[model samples]
Target: MNGDWLAEGRAELAAERILDAVRMLFVEKGASAVGMAEVAETAGCSRATLYRYFDNRQALYVAFAGREARQLIERVWLNRSINSEAGRADQLLDAIASVLAEVRKTPHLAVWFEPANSGIVAQLSNSSDVIDAIGAGFVAGYRPALTDSAARLLGQWMIRVVVSLLTLPGGGEDEERAMLRNFVMPFLLDDTTTIE
Candidate 1:
């Protein structure tokens, strides 16, 4: 048991180091340009060693995106703020807007939404169960009355909206807020709920 634990720890550490190398390359060259061999060299590990951890470049990209997504979720969740006067609909809108602002501020993450890379990032996010679950949790927390299926669907839609905004931001914060409020809030929250 002790040996197994130690091996697992070592393995996780190696993978983390590899991911750190990848982050540097991503910031320098953009995510699309990174390759496994370049990552291996940057990590000071053999290609064989890198491949053992991640089967290919796509796997590595997914792993990195997954890690960043988790961090982004945590950061947004931790800093979530809802005014007492704000209704449930307003609260949900706030959460969605918060995610967009945070990602834009985070350079490492924001790069994924660059014009050249946005499509790929969107595809990865759609396919990632982790990303979907985070979105679902956000919706379920706000709307406990929703059925599982309904919450899941809403969550997927919320994530897509975030991706869309990231890929192509509105003219300004006012425009973005209007888009969310006028278009998304109605579908997400009942008419009985107050906007403020």
Candidate 2:
């Protein structure tokens, strides 16, 4: 009751609504079709209020992608039990499949994840600090033997491959994922090691 709980509560609600609207907008319209006003209206707030939270469309877009990536990775990590499941490629595969499949469902997010989606949203690709943070989070627990660049590149490539699968003409998720484990496993994960 002491910390201006009323204002804080209102602010939290507004932020959540705006973020949710932004995410939905991204899913429905990609980057070009949606604007701050649309996002504000979708959030059921005024554009002036939305601007108070985010400086510009790009910043909100970045926040939206960042939030999505965090949630996706958290889900994957929880499902795979990545911390406790040691040396289990199958579990890792399950986790990755879930993440990719979910991402594939969101066309705008998926499109942005691709290198080519750079045209839609700047932060979805290499230009995004949010993505870099996500990459850092992924590599944080990785074995020290794998250089930072290697770990980041491996993760980025895996994401790209799956996104490509989603947008590509024919190949299915299973095939691409299977091929990934086959070729990339040697460098990133050892067979006998258990992560969980």
Candidate 3:
């Protein structure tokens, strides 16, 4: 039995505890309501210790959110959207759908991405590995000339649009997906696709 395993396990457990505290506070109150002190208190760590792990509240929230986005983009979106040999345009639309589908299912994550939170999140966005991936996914093969601003607009728009769809009280899944497809294709589908 390797004692190194026990050391690594303790590190993992502490990281998870901190993240759990962040999630609980941010969910119960908006991201604005949670601060480093609150997180430290909830996580059973001293403020100095929490700061040792994460520099600040925005750092903690952004890091956690970015990590979640990366996993969702890779596991759920990339896996579901990109076929073995798909072109970039098809991959882009499918990736958009996959991300929105995830946001629809996980509203709490959506809260962290809200415009109200954007002032802080936007600052952290400059360093986001996940947003970088999402942006790169948009720029690849589909539209090499696409501007970064447009990609950002489209990404946030997709999330807002999907939230509207899910808030509709009641609707059949097929019908909703079809409705989403019809509404989204014009803007998101490749300009090369002929609309009938």
Best by lDDT: 1
- What is the TM-score of candidate 2? 0.71
Looking at model 3, residue 76 earns an lDDT score of 68
Give the per-residue lDDT of model 3 (tens digit) for 2-110.
2232354486676667888887887787776788888878888777777767887767876787766676767665555333444644555565556666765675666
- Under the 3 Å rule for N, CA and C atoms, how many clashes does model 3 have? 0
List the lowest-lDDT window of 10 residues for candidate 1.
Answer: 1-10
User: Which residue pairs in candidate 2 collide?
Assistant: 84-196, 85-195, 85-196, 86-194, 86-195, 86-196, 87-193, 87-194, 87-195
| Candidate with the greatest TM-score versus the true structure | 1
Candidate 2, 1-196: lDDT as tens digits: 1233236557776677789887788677666678998987888777777898889987887777777777877766644445554655666666666776777676756756544455554335545666765664564454445566765665565555555554452477667677757865554456343333
Clash pairs, model 3 backbone:
none
TM-scores of all predicted structures = 0.85, 0.71, 0.60
Give Cα distance to truth, residue 6, candidate 3, Å. 12
The digit string of per-residue lDDT tens for model 1 on 36-152 reads 889988987888888989998878887887788788878776466443545766776777788899988877777788998876787787777777777777777767677777777
Error of 2 at 21 (Å): 1.3
Model 2 local distance difference test score: 0.64
Show pairs that collide, candidate 1: none
Model 2 segments beyond 4 Å from truth? Answer: 1-9, 83-87, 106-118, 121-123, 142-170, 190-196
What's the lDDT of the predicted structure labeled candidate 1? Answer: 0.79
